[model samples]
Target: MTRVAVVGLGMMGLTHLNVYRSLSNVTIAAICDADADRLSGETTATGNVEGTADASVKSLPAEVRRCSDLNEVIGAADVDVVDICLPTHLHVRFGKQVLLAGQHLIVEKPLARNSTDADELAQAARSAKGLAFVGQCMRFWPGWAWLKDAVNDGRYGKVLAATFRRVVDHPKGAFYENGDLCGGALLDLHIHDTDFVHYLFGMPKSVNSFGYSKNTNEPDHVVTRYLYDHVPLVVAEGGWAMSDGFPFSMSYNLNFENATVDFDINREQSLRICEVGKPIEYPEVDAKMGYDLQLAYFIDCIEKQRKPETVTLENAADTIRIVEAEAESIKTGSAVSLG
Candidate 1:
């Protein structure tokens, strides 16, 4: 069994802890959070294991350990992997400590603050034998995974273009509002779109993006144009600020030579395929607790000694490059070419 630790006590951090619980091979051996009370209380929270195993609406088993020091949980103990659910800026610092301690890392999106740090982490992992992988969970999303294969396998038939959109209400938390944290929707939010898009489309030749930021200190929405040879790419990104309705939403439209696949993780929870092979469908994901699959994938990667779909340092760097370019374009109002 692999020992696991949840490094933060926020929403996503709690989700990571729940995931560790559901997996038989992985154990929630330790949990560390700055908020000692929330960390300790989470052990008995009812909804901790509810959806994809996050919301419980029940009760937690006793005997769960809560630690206050990050170093004890990450460095001192025999934890096999440290799940860094901390904010984007903190990812690098914590990940470095984990790697230096000869432990593996599985962090949330936007692996580091900048491309240089992303590269350095990648190299550090190279020197550490126990180091396994780091990445976001979006690629493991079943609906998106199936469609990526369909397009790559020619089921989509000479795919011509693609579009992605994700929006959410403003994050009502101090961690999200921290200025020293990652920038705009570009870094924190759009990185998801950029990483997943890169996973599907490979590297883009150039990038052009324009957007405005909110006083809360991040772009609530953004439009990014990716240039790839002989392909059409336009990704519109949004998140958490357009909190007008009861539920936030995300949708994607994929144009292939013969058909189109429409997937809405928020609205419908199913993929609607048109013009070919009858309408394809996907299972609706529970938003509140759908993180189990992602955690499952991470455990699988650790077991298989393989890199995760969207969590590799390479993929992280690519996503960062797109975001960096987007910010540059926002400043210069000119398209930026990428290598």
Candidate 2:
């Protein structure tokens, strides 16, 4: 069995633990967190997508280890994989630690806060003995995953125009209030769509973005148009600036030469296709959530001793670079040329 340790007891951390427990050949060897209460299961954290923690996750099994120090977890012989679910700022520091220890590493999305740190982390992953994978989970998400396949296989002919959107109420926590630490919604939230956009259609030639800030000086709501030569129109909008009661939304609309695909997380039929003189078709996807799918992929990669091609350090770094360009565009109120 592949032993795994998850650091951080936040929403994502707990989510990772749940996923790991459900897998066949994997075991949660340890859980690390600086917060004593979190480490001991006195308090719980939640995310926008999933609500309160499951009963099984409120506390781990007796055999599973718990520690407050990261070093101890990395040094443990029983641990073969360290999943870093800490804040964005801590990713680079702890990520390098796991790699240096020659243990498989899984760093949650955005890789790092900026290009400089991302580059540093990417280099460490390259030189490390163990394999590295970034948690760009959108690539594995059900509806979103189906969209990627359709784009590549051209089931409905070339994509004519595509628009993606994700929006939710601002998240709570002091860490979020500080723009530098979280990179605001543009980096923390919108990067999901940005990375997915890259996964579907390579990097764009240029990007024009518009943004609005509600809590901090940094942009919280962002709408970017990705310019490309082959595709006629491609745009994405994401933010966490909605009101308290606003429901979480992640949806997309794609117009292909002969068909159109529409996806909404809130809809009963999440993914639907339309074509002239034909009935709408709903495509079925894997029942697993993106988090579970991503972790499973990494476990398979580790077991096979194969490198992950789906989402790599370089690819994650490039996603940051693209988001940085979007931030610049938001500042200048003009299109930023990436080429």
Candidate 3:
């Protein structure tokens, strides 16, 4: 069995805890957080997204150790994997500590606040004895994953154009309000689509962006066009600046040579396909939350002593680099060239 320790009992942390409880081959070796209440099972976390698998777990397992310090979690002999779900700024530091302790590492999205720090963690991961993976969940999401395979396998022929969107009500809490810490909605929320865009089609030659801020100097709502040589059109819009009571939604539209794939989280049939003479078709997908599948993937990699190719530390860093270009493009009011 793989023993796991999860640090930071925030929204993502609690999500991870619930998933770990559901996995048959995993054991919750420890749970760490700065908050003593969470460590002691007196507090619980609620995420922005609804329908998370078993978010009702408020108590830690009897066999699991609870700690209020990262050092303790890193030093524990029972822990074979360290999952870092801390805030954006704390990722590199705590992640490095996990690597230094020779534990397999899984860091949450937006691996670091900036590319510089992302590179540092990537270097550390490269030298660590254990494997490393980043939770870029969109690549594994049911509908999105289907799109990836369709685009790559040419089942729908070549991708001609695409549009992606993720918009939600502003998250509660001061941490999210601070642009420096959370990197605004563009980096914090929009990075999901940005990374997935890169995953489906390689890095773009440039990015043309327009954004406006609601919370800080950073862009709160941004629309970016990823310029590619072969793909005629690729645009993504994401933000959390919507008014209160606005529903959370993520959707995409892809045009291929032979068919069109449409996905919307709010729809009854979330994944749809349309060909020239065929009626609309809804494809069956694994339909599992990306969060759960990503961790399971990491465990499988660890068991086989293989590196993760789906989402790597370097690839996560590259996503941040792409976000940086988008930010720059927003600031300059022009398209920024990227290699």
Which candidate has the top score in lDDT? 2
Tell me how far the alpha carbon of residue 324 in candidate 1 is from the true structure, in angstroms, after superposition.
0.7
User: Model 2 residue 312 lDDT?
Assistant: 92
Q: What's the CA RMSD for each of the models?
A: 3.4, 1.3, 1.2
Off by over 4 Å in 1: 42-60, 244-246, 276-290, 306-310
Q: 260-311, model 3: which lDDT tens digit per residue?
A: 9899988888888998789989877666789988988889999999999989
Q: By lDDT, rank the candidates, best first.
A: 2, 3, 1
Q: Worst lDDT window (10 residues) for model 2? A: 50-59
**Model 3 stretches astray by more than 4 angstroms:** 53-57
TM per prediction? 0.88, 0.97, 0.97
Candidate 1: global Cα-lDDT?
0.70
